[model samples]
Target chain A: MNIHLTDQPIDVAAVLASVQDEGAGAVNTFIGTVRNQSTGRRVVRLDYEAYDAMAVHQMRRVAEQAREKWPMLCQVAIIHRKGRLEIGDVAVVVAVSTPHRADSFAACQYIIDTIKQVVPIWKKEEYEDGSVWVAAHP
Target chain B: MKLKIALFGIAKEIVGSSQLELEAPERQSVADLIAQLRAQYPALNALTSFAVAVNSEYAPEDYCLRENDEIALIPPVSGG
Candidate 1:
């Protein structure tokens, strides 16, 4: 139950440790990075923002949903970074541990997907010539 | 009654403020608040979609808003 929206760089090892469990045989982790290019434009950087309190609340719901869906899950950790980010920087990390590999993988994917859909967080893409808020326009 | 609403992401940019206070008749619904906001800030209508959160949880359109409710304007989310 380690859900966090942090402003600092995410420590992958720390995130993994938070979900460590002796009963779990598999630990599935997903790390989302800021890619250098989006569409046809070369992204210079990205600015991430969150409605901090609501973001955390929604992330907790995502973890809860995962746990309910995957009874075998031992633990869950979701860490998302905010503020300025450069190309290749890690933006988010999702980790799930379970007795078997399949459950861990499924739960990890579900958590990340739900977070993107429900969390009150946003990222602004900065290209060489201009900037735009991702998903802002219809 | 007057209610204060929190703005985030593009909503904040569109309104040019992080928070705003608006006067509404008592027991107005969330949808009414949104309509009022759109009337005041037409730029909000340009977004793909948006949701209203009351006390950090997504509120239904028919949900009644109370004074001092921690309402937030949620623009289209793009988090990973």
Candidate 2:
């Protein structure tokens, strides 16, 4: 189980290594970082929160779905950061390895997409003037 | 029955607490819980949408909540 939710910065190299396999021909990785601006606001930092137990459970579910869809996938690693993060800080990483290149790419993308939709995690954007929970309002 | 609703992100800020205690009937559904909560914390109604989770899984509107079941008010998630 490579899924993790930590307050510390994500170890991208470790995540990539977690999916290493001799038979795997491709390892695909998706890294999400905090941006300097959002919707034209100069973002200062982001505060992330999560329902710890449920977030991990949802991430695992997403991983399982990806594996079921791409049986050739050898391994999967998903890591999400919590607490405060500055611009350019890594927020999440999804790495996948497979016997071929296509499955690895597809599974990695699928895992991140599903995690965003289903995972019980939230991020608040802070600007110089005010802050808001991203996507909290229509 | 007594229910403790866990709040997160904006929901927590609106309620000014991470957890809340509510007194409800034994047969309260998820929808009933939401209505009660929104009335108590009107700011929650302003959010685009929210979800209810029972014991860590998303619960349907009509899902009946039981005692000792973990319940949470989930604001719109923005994780990447």
Candidate 3:
């Protein structure tokens, strides 16, 4: 399991390499990027803030859940970015490897969906006129 | 009895102080603490979805509070 919160771009290929070993026949990845539009407004940039300790803890918990549900899983990597991000920036990256393709896909989806619901993170949208805090979740 | 509360994110800024000392009688339920919190900090009125955490873990509305416990008002959750 690998979890990272950093300004540096997430190394998707490198992370895949870590988990793609002999027993892992399939790997799945999900990349979340900063969207150019939101709620009918043009987004210029986004600033993400997270409680570091809680965020890391949440990631570890997600990984633990995946391992528990799927014993065949080989590895899981989840990385999130902090600080200001442009419209095209990569906000989150999730990759999972399992013995088969179906498990990889299911586990990847579960991790991403769970993260959206439980992670404690806030996003501020910077538009042309001003900025508005999204007021909820990672 | 007075209980201390800690605010985070927007709530923290609106309350002016990261922590506030609220006056509530002993053995008050978590929901009671919220009522006093909303009354004391009118700005919190805008926040409709806050979870009460006693000693850093989630507690239901019926959960009771003690003076020794540390209560946090968690803002709406966001993650992904």
Docking class of 2: high
Q: Measured with DockQ on alpha carbons, how good is candidate 2?
A: 0.87
User: Which candidate comes out best when scored by TM-score?
Assistant: 1
Runs with alpha carbons beyond 4 Å of true place in candidate 1: none
RMSD value for candidate 2: 0.9
Model 2 TM-score is: 0.97
Q: lDDT: which candidate is best?
A: 1
**Local error of candidate 3 at residue B24 (angstroms):** 5.6
Q: What TM-score does each model's chain B reach against the true chain B? A: 0.96, 0.97, 0.85
Model 2 chain B lDDT-worst window of ten: B36-45
Error of 1 at A39 (Å): 1.3
What is candidate 3's TM-score against the reference?
A: 0.83
DockQ-wise, the better of 1 and 2 is 1
The TM-score obtained for chain B of candidate 2 when compared with the true chain B: 0.97
Ranking by lDDT: 1, 2, 3
lDDT of 2 by residue, B9-80 (tens): 999999999999999999899999999988988988999999999988999999999889999999999898
The DockQ scores of all candidates, in the order shown, are: 0.88, 0.87, 0.38
Q: What class would a CAPRI assessor give candidate 1's docking?
A: high
lDDT string, candidate 3, B8-74, tens digits? 6667767887787877777999888888778877767776577776654567999878887877777
**Runs in model 2 with CA error above 4 Å?**
none
